[model samples]
Target: MCSRYVGFILLVWFPGALHAQSAARHCPAPALVGGYFVPVKETYSHDFQLTYACENTYKPAVEGWWATSVCQDGTWSHTPQCIDEKGCFPPTIANGKYTHASDGWYEEESVIRITCDKGYEHKNNLATAKCANGTWSSLPTCEQSIKTCSMPPKVPHAVIVHQGYLELFPEDSKVHYECKDGYRMEGSDKNPIVCLAGTWTEYPTCSKVTVRGDHTSTERGTQPGSGGGGGSRPDSGHVSVEVGTGRGHSTSSGPGTQPGSGGYPSTSDTRPIMIPIKDCGTWPLVPNGVVVVQDRMFLKFTCNAFYTQVGPEDVVCYNDGSWSQIPICKDAFCVMVPGYYTYGLRLSENQFIKEGELTYIPCEWNDYSVAVRCTDRRITHTSCCRSYDHQWKRCSIVRENFLPVGSLIKK
Candidate 1:
């Protein structure tokens, strides 16, 4: 069935018809034995030629199959047949995959789109390949796109873990930034800078760490240097600070030697203050139908399928390091009304109600019908009474379930 063996074939049995003309007067084009013919005509004159084409993913079995068939003296000179062309197999790529094509075949000049999996990136912009004459041309590969950050900048009185190495950093790399024995990060020791897009993020500053006998860190803004006992406070005159740029040197700024005065500590330079949930030593836990985004430092709520979100979508982190008001997820459908038989009850799944939808429920023993609608985040019920005379009257139900507006209902 391969198309490579395409050549002419001769038959010795039809020797007389090689030069003989047909007995019929009109030489309509004969039907092809195999494959299909193009430019179909209602009537064919003598010596008319018609072209034939094969189906998709197929080629002519013989070179003459691509040539025109002649209708001479009401007969075809030869019948054309088609065969399958050699196709390219699935390509092998690293860190990437090829998209599936229809019929699972790669024809000549077929372009295959390539995509890298998560945590990987395409090298250079060559994300595609073409099949040419049963061979793939210049197949591209996906390389590890992780970029490690260089060593962190030097900060006095602080101990950085996994420091300095040109090839150590990768995308989303995290490094521990803790202060030494008598020092702590400006705000907290757990705060670490992440590497993103081949660059290291901003790191926290180191300040003098004050520890009480109970092992709890003292609040920022407290002056350092203790006096009489382990629990005694430092003198108000001497301000504890770093001196001479060494890890072990400690000095105090005199009353006159404030900030801007010969490298003395400033009043603004104090211990790190605690932020709300960020200082809890762990990421905050989010409830169902919600997700936590560390980048914006907030919890975003999202409803499940067939449910509608009623509250805010974005909860942002404030400048004070505290989180803003978080929104809640709400159910989309209303609750089923009591003491009513609805039409097509068996067909419904009896799930949560959808907002802006109208449902009909008939009275169990009476002809009275009720129409319940979900709108404006609340459910409204309307009653239709079928009187003795067969007249219908619209009434309102006061004992119906009332869903409060702006209230979140978990599905």
Candidate 2:
């Protein structure tokens, strides 16, 4: 309808032997000669080169319409291109390849430039080439970029600080042990040191307490000769002591039990017990309170060895029931608070509590009360009364509960 121009853009690409390949004078056919007039031009960069005036396939024997892009500035031609179905050149990208080829004869390398897939490095290179008399050249592009290991911290016990390596196992590296104060802790506290390299798979121990009477503390052991303690005492009741020594003959009453002194065992036909015993002495039948009874019941009167086992020798008869309750064997044994031993339970007679067990005793609740038999030691809030003589067995002169009037007397 409105022809802009069209010389001949028919590269019908081989066929129809009709030589008239001459036409580039701005569309000549269409004044009404036959039927081939195609003129569509937006002016070079104005892009629109599809000129076809029945030339054939690049069809357009040369009639009208042709001038895609390339003619701005000094505009003489070049930049018009269109060749799709794989002619291998500007078949895409705004489609336009045919800057007046044989039509006006204006050519530079023609046109061809396309590079996108292959690791794609986009920058600028959509080339074009048509220099066989046309002209178009400039294409080149290729791009790829992204590169990780960071871990190290925390080396306490076993000293295992991975990634950067710090391992200290059976003995390869790392070692520095130290722990003392009643001894605390066992193995692998990380780098606690010791297995510097050879034979210290794990070492940390000091838990020590020899067990003579009662003791406990544990962290671990086995260093010097290692550890050792073998004890056995049960010959009926144990008296086999090795300390002050005093067995058989004397059971307890007060002074020198003879042999090596320290006696408190007097069995007069078995009489005489005013309660005064130091070591051990006089006994064969001498007993005011020595019951080794067995049947009045099968008997389990167990007091469980205390005077420090040896044999039944000290006075004899012990497997577990030695003198059973004989307390007064004092040489030295008081402040001991573990489980309770010495006078363990008998809170009567001469007031013995070497740390006995009235349930671990610390009782103050309501502030002082349970005071059974007391004498002159003065200390009372709710209770405190004493009066035992049973026949002058002695020990009973204490009354300090509500005393204030002349403060009582009669020691």
Candidate 3:
């Protein structure tokens, strides 16, 4: 009976001792690159966990800046590492792909070219992107390209000059128009309507012409006859005649006879006639302009600062109840051409300069600049020279003299 009890106790004690030995087993401190671990020790027992953090510009290989690992059975559950944070992942773009196939990470300042799929183009016409310090610059987006414009709107009393059977017009295409008979174009005949992107510019208008002599007036008169029945034949005397102007006619009537015996010619007689005159209402509105003179039969218009009058400045109202001609105000700003530079400053393309304003254009010589003025949509004074004294030499001179730099070009 004593031997059996000793064997049972030995079996339970052996199992407990094995468990303690296993628990005492330890793992060496893990080595991390570009990082350090917290609560560091020479060795760690089983189930012991340690936290690690990476240095600046470096990230843990696991997930975040900090990570954890455990010592299990004399071995670490995970090996910690820190990698460069200045690298970028592959960019995912819709309706676009990289010009060159690349699957690896992109380093800082690396450029990548992108190509949009068919029927699409890069936004703002940009086709490349650069990785800047772990983050990519603004990437170009794929958008549907506008290549053509639909049929242009029709203008009253005007027809397209040379339009063919085609329905769509390519971008930047221009179409001319001609006014029909009895009508005149209100805008400039040289400037044609243009197609821009997917739309057409404003079409020109044709105004009708009012013909003269459409209204008329008439008057009646009578000459004396040889008969003498003065007092009694006052109502029936003389030959009456009628005359008219503008679409009127003439008429005549025979003389009257006396009551007793032979008839006698009557005295002259005259009758007054009245006619209504045609009147034109208020003056027509002028865009970008104002009416300087407004009268019952006359009107005058003046354009704004940057606009020009396209027609006559004054108009007259005729007897047909219509004005002679209505004027329009057109844009008169100067457009900056390519390679336009002035006074050490480079002007942007298509820059608008208002009328009556001055612009200094750079000359062939670095020290010289040409003074040009915008007048009625035209650039005046295109000559340039190194000095005002040498203005006549080495430059295409104009009739008008150039203004001094101090007068126009401000510092």
Measured over all alpha carbons after superposition, the RMSD of each candidate to the real structure, in angstroms, is 20.7, 42.6, 23.0
Best by TM-score: 1
Residue 359, model 1, lDDT:
45
Per-residue CA lDDT of candidate 1, range 321-398, in tens? 334556644445555533343332222322234577664443433334445566654666654544222222355553
What TM-score does model 1 achieve against the real structure? 0.26
Ranking of models by TM-score: 1, 3, 2
**C-alpha lDDT values of all predictions:** 0.49, 0.26, 0.56
lDDT of 3 by residue, 170-197 (tens): 5677888887886667666544977653
Put the candidates in lDDT order, highest first. 3, 1, 2
Model 3: weakest 10-residue lDDT segment is 219-228
Candidate 1, residue 36: Cα displacement in angstroms equals 27
- Which of the two candidates, 1 or 2, achieves a greater TM-score against the reference? 1
Candidate with more favorable, higher TM-score: 2 or 3: 3
The number of the candidate with the highest lDDT is 3
Where model 1 places Cα greater than 4 Å from the true spot, the runs are 1-85, 146-195, 204-411
Candidate 1 — what's its lDDT? Answer: 0.49
With a 3 Å backbone cut-off (N, CA, C), the pairs that clash in candidate 1 are 27-74, 148-169, 148-170, 149-169, 332-353, 333-353, 333-354, 334-353
| Prediction-by-prediction clash tally | 8, 90, 5
Error of 2 at 361 (Å): 88
Candidate 2 C-alpha error for residue 395, in Å = 99
